[model samples]
Target: MISQHDFRQNVSIFENSLKIEFKVVIKSFVKLNKLFILWLIFVPGLLFSSSKNDSLLQVYNKHHSDTIGLNALHEYARNLQYEDFDSTYKTNVLLSNLCFSNLFEKKNLTARERYINIYFLGNTYNSQSIYFMEKGDYVKSLELLEKSIQWWSLAYKDYLESYKNEIYLGLSSSYSNKGSAEDYLGDFAMAMDSYTKALRLNDFVKRNCDSSLLNFVLNSEAITSFNIAMIFENMGEVNKSQKQYSKALELFTALTKLKDERVVVTGFLGTSNVLTALGKIYFKKEEYSVSIGYYNRALQIINSLNLKYNNRFNTEYADILTQLGIQYKKTQNYNRALELFDKALTIRRELGNKRLISISLNNISSLYYNMGKYKESLLASAESWKLAEEAKVPQQKIKASEGMADSYEKLGNYKEALIWHKVFKEVTDSLTDQESIKNASTIEARYQSEKNENDLKLLNAEKRLAEQKIIQQKADMASFQIKMWSAIILSLMIILSALITIFAIRQRHKRILKEKLLEEEKNRLRTVIDMQEKERTRIARDLHDGIGQLLSAASINFGMLGKTSQIMESESELFSSSMKILNDACTELRSISHEMMPRSLQDAGLSTALNELVVRSFKNTSIEAEFEILGALERLPQLVENGLFRICQELIGNIIKHSGASEVIIQLYKTSNEWILRVEDNGRGIISADTENGIGIKNIKARVSVLNGSLNYENGPEKGLITSVKIPIYGQN
Candidate 1:
């Protein structure tokens, strides 16, 4: 068994081995070919790096030393603006892959780190997408920008919970980039809407207010608006184009007044761009002086801020100079025009700004056309078209086409001029339509996604509430059941207590009544005994003095006479009948005395006494009575035993006299708690209502009361009469 420490060590070792393998793969890939190494390193860098540091290989190398060729690749990408299509394409592919890899890894990172990395990936994708757009690959550009948006959205999701403003800023920037892509693809309307949404989101967070950032935003917005204005102007919507250009100028002018270094540099560039747009518009309007004033302003700002915009500013400044040269040519100032062309051409060639070079070449060609130097002008315009095509700027292509048309027309080649003019119109028109379509689709997609998300959230909230109500209902039902059962059990307890109290009270009442009846019976017995004693004495004296002497004298005299007379015969029969009557009365008196108080019950015990009484009472009747005794009936009180025996006798007598019953059964059982006596007969049942206090029933009830017993009599439907009595012998108070 491994100890915890050893287990931890083993895990650490495993992790280290995995990390080493990862490092090996990174190094091996980086060491392959220079271009391949750059591709490998930059892709991961863009994929893994934060949004702020979008330079691919530099970001990759910062993360791990394993990216040995990353720094070299980053340098290569920095110089990518000068590379050919193939080089740029390869670089973009690498950057796109790097961003994808970064996003994959970013999922496992902490929320903050993940957000930063994904944001970096978004920026990389955005750059590549823009590059693709520049190459006239709108589909690929759209795909890359969508991926960028997705990543940025995820990053925003992570950030929104804690840093609401930061995420919103990121979202605004992502949307702005999307707008730019759409704009480039000829989707002007959708592009404008996307840009508007971005601005709104940007305003929601007040962080990007520093002059540099503000100027950056303003310049971007102005450029996009200016592009739209140029489209409108080309399409012959002069007023709309002017409106957009005016908006662009307003933003650019505001930036120029700012003091920040970055703002001042961007403002100068923006002001020049606005002037150039104004010059185009004025040239279309045939307003030379107004166009010249804007053109001159553009030239002054560019020359003054030359160092601020780096080498890039030289290209725009050169184009403006060529346009000025054209303006001079149009006004027939050939010397001044030629002089301006030379200055613009030199700057363009030096800076390798091919598009600007083409423009300056075209201007020189046009000046020659004005001077009637047809051969020189034709050669110049041809070279300018070649450079324009090579530069790959659509606007430059248009300018080059116009120059070719002019050169052709001046040489009396009207067909060629007309052909070039038509080509220029067709390309610009197609570009406008494409841009417009892209813009519309983008806005629609965004709006639909937001609406669906909101609807889903509402549905989820309602579902949760419904589930909560169901749970609460179940809880209430359970509580109700518990209370109901509690009430039922409580009621049962109360009923049990009441039954016990009633039983106790009834027993007490029975005991009192039994004692009272027994007392009354005892007093009656004493009075009967007293009367019997008095009668016995009177009879004895009468027999001795009168009847005895008379009977004796008569018997002796009659025997001596030996005569059969009628009077003597009658007297003898009468005497016999009288003696029989007397004997039956004496037996009945003895039975009554025994019934009132039985000596056998006192002497022979309950079972034996019960047997004797049943045999004697039923012997004279047709009833066949059976007496069954169970348990040890000896321990019970004499009074209780005697009372139970009498109850059995009374029940049997009722069956014999009233029911004309043929059979009677008496059962005397002495259980631990009580003595039970049951008497049943095949007889007409006694009516409990009528016979409750009749002589035999009252006597039995009195005796039962003395013993504190209970009696139950059922007039059973099939079995005639059933009487049962239970005396709780031990619990008697």
Candidate 2:
């Protein structure tokens, strides 16, 4: 048998080896199959290229003689970028060299052809930069992005009017990519500057681009807005971040209403991202429930698209899961929180995302510490610290250090705890040092100043353009007036015709309005007639069921007494019972009559009537009912009082029947301007009040409408229903 210590050591070594092997295998697989994986992920657009693109590629390959061939090649390259980035990069390099060589050799290329070539080259560089950025190679991405910007700038100057906007858009995209790279590299000031440049370019495109291109430009602008929001959120500028996020949400929402399928998909994805960002912001603000709602909406979209396996989707999903875990942890749902954190960690590790991996590890560490698993927490913290060091993310490093310190302190390793505590303090202090804080503040201020300056310049330009437009309009107006004077008699005839048309339209509109009002009056009268008929039917049924039966019983009893007719004790008892039954029949008839139009409402006013109605409705029900009257009570018009009483009766009946309520509170109060009737119940609130409408609700709504009052139903505090009706107290009598 193996010694216990030796067996444990062997198991540990084996686990370490297995982890190493697993990582190596995963990395190798990804490296070897990256192109295939990309193609699969983008299969929707890549696997089935447009026939036009295919034909262009075929023509370019078969005959490469002139600018047409170059254009075809550019189109092919554009299609290739989504499918295979390496192929696109190589093809673009050759295309660029060929175009440059032709220019040098005096091959008579048109300016448009040259500009197209340059723009295509810039797009290729930008595409490559995006690839590198996704791979976390910020420096290399920055270099390529700068090159793309340069090429796009040149193209912007050379391109024709129709193509200028496209080139500017390309430049904007490149600058945005550069900003992302700079942000990842911790140069926030530079990142802000780059994003500002992109925003300006996007604005120019939006103002000048044709309607056909407007949607695409707007989508790009929304994306840039979202990115800027993210940067502001990272910089702790909550107000600016929220403003940009709101702007992005508005743009995306509008885009989703568009008819274009491509625009709709883009809008959905963008909207989901904005929602997730809002959720994070709210999460930080400790609005946990609101954050969860946003997160759930985002997750719904991602899952509905079946995009969980996509890298971008995975990243976002993991982020949301991690956030939810934190929320659950705060709520003391340790098991659920742990499960979510582990899921997020697994995704990050599989994607080989070092930065996110470190962050996830730190999160897990913190959760473990919260759970009081000091040993596990320390181990996770150590791994997190190592990963943070490798990723070179200061925030992750600080979080890991703090986790380690806490874990060590909990484990009674005071010396080690002190060391980590000092490290955490140093990192925290450096981040919040006066100089660093000042620099960050200065960067934010500079960004604002630059934005304001750009706005001023844009305003000046717009003013100049407006002045020119006004001058042109005035000249046109003068010319139009001169032409009108030459045909003054015809113009007068036309104006008279127009006046007649306007008069006819006005007369028609008045007739339609009058007809509509008459129709509405008819409907109201019909509703009142129907309600009265129904009430009569109900009263008739009650009399037949109650008074008629009692009278029949009493008559039979008296007849039996007459048949006995001996002045015996049984006969005497039968006569007394008959008298009692006859008395009840009379009382039942009176109650039925009163119910048709409650006598209490007429005699004692609305307050007493409502209280009596509640008492009668909930008399034997499980629901505890109470009624309260506030303010000085006075009489109201008969119609108003009757309507109020009927509405209250209907609501109380609804609560007893459908609300599953344990308690109900009905209040009638008078404010300075209005009378408020509130009915609250502790029960399952209305799930679909519109679709689940019963006769009771319909009756209440009709009565309220007739009274020119408003009725509202919503969920009450602590899982119940609240129904409020407000009527203007017009001269209470």
Candidate 3:
């Protein structure tokens, strides 16, 4: 037979050998599948690009008139917006200059020629605005958007009767671009208004345009709606954001049914953006798993499009990866999260985008902080801060500084931590101030615009009234009639006020009655709990006094019988076994009685009772149990103490019976106004099914409900299960 130490050594060797084999298998699989994986990643983008290029080539081969050629050029440039950033901008600039010098400067131009020129110019300007917006130059982007709107307005004025829908599409595109810039500038109200206007224009285009043009307008509407959703998301209006996102998704899904490849591709990309935005909103809400699902769907579209290497696609992919990493981190998949973060960082580096790089570094720093690698966290945070400063991005700077502060605190460097914390606070305050100023400006602009419109309406009405007064001479008599009716209106107002007062009084009484009912229900629950505890105490007393004494007497009598000289050897052995069994029965009864209403709980209080419970539960078991108490462990009310003790007992019992847990920790702590009890076990987590059926869990919930405490069960950071209960300690100093 193998000794215990030898057995342990053999198991250790086997585990080591198994791990080595697993690593070798993994490496071999990766090597064998490398090309297959690369092909999967590369093929979709190639097909998408090939199809798109073929369409553009056919247009170029047609060699239409200069005007048609210019239209084709614009379309080609638009398609390259995500594919080749620099080339798209240059092409748009060329197209803009060509339209201005070649067509706009011509004398005696036809209305058709002028309209085309204006449309092309507007389209070019709008495209340029988008380019600048992506580069983080919101002011420049906004200026170009305004120029685009000017050109679109000219086109609308010149040919509204003939091509109103077309002009509306151009104007809508321009306004959407404007909205994006305003959103980036933190002017959420303005962004919302711009997007609203864009949506309205797109709706007009959608209603009046032919099938082909209708699909285009629908895609634009989806894009504009997505922008509005993002603005709402930024403004913290979750319901509005979600509503708009759903609307956008519907529009984009419809567009996907179109036969036009360009429209179809645009629809797919738009859908992806909306999906990503939804993910961001859910991530903000801390619905990590839900957010991950949305993000993965978005990634699937990008993969399908085979556009992962496109500038915009790369940024989107990196962001998705980083966000997915964060969710994985929350779920405590540390190694997998680290791998994702590293991948995101690599992509950001390849792109050489400072803002994204800073974001990636800050995320990595946070991951390190969570992993307790403080020095590495500090290094990553410092680099992130430097990059954020260079990029002049306030949000990234705040995140990096906060990360650094946390790292310093973890490393026991309070001075450095304080310094970074102050920096983080200052930057956050600055950002808040900037947002406030933008909001004030947006409000003022809206007020001024509304006031001007109102003034114009008032002036127009006054002029019309002046003309009517001259034509009618009885205007003064009409004014007197209006004054006579005002007195009757005042009496009606008084009556309404009286009615409102009566309603208010009724509401106050109803509120008072509701409060009384709640208090009575609480009192009833308290009585029930008291009665239960009394019954338990009574039972424990009876078991200890009645059954326990009888069992002990039986054991003593049996022992006496076994010692008699007249007894045969066989009879004596039988007597000895009976006595031993009786003794064990007596001991078990005493233990059960003690457990029913532990004397230590009443004599020593909650902390000692919990500690003793932990010690007894795992006394000779393989499991290791620990108890910790924080803050002042004052004696709670008897009811409260009893409920807490039973809760702990139930959790421990569950752990031992079902968890297969190797280690358990029980903590009881007091805060300023609450007592918190936490029982955590290194075992399989409590699944939903287990929670629904477990009698012990049900009992625990009842006790917590009686105490008006909250009970929460969740997976721990690394593994196993954590249960936390918090009860407010009322009237406690």
| Per-model TM values vs. the true structure | 0.41, 0.48, 0.49
| Candidate 3 clashing pairs, residues 3+ apart or interchain | 44-306, 45-306
Who wins the lDDT comparison? 3
**Cand. 3 Cα-lDDT:** 0.77
Best by TM-score: 3
- Kindly give the stretch of ten consecutive residues in candidate 3 with the minimal lDDT sum: 1-10
Model 2 TM-score, all chains together:
0.48
CA deviation > 4 Å runs, candidate 2: 1-60, 63-109, 156-163, 258-262, 307-312, 412-733
Clashing pairs in model 2, backbone N/Cα/C closer than 3 A: none
What lDDT tens digits, residue by residue, belong to model 2 across residues 544-625? Answer: 6676677767767766866866767766877777677676676667666666656677678999878777887787788899
Pick by TM-score: 2 or 3, better one: 3
Candidate 3 local lDDT, 551-580, one digit each (tens): 888887777766665788677778667777
- Range of the 10 consecutive residues with the lowest summed lDDT in candidate 2: 1-10
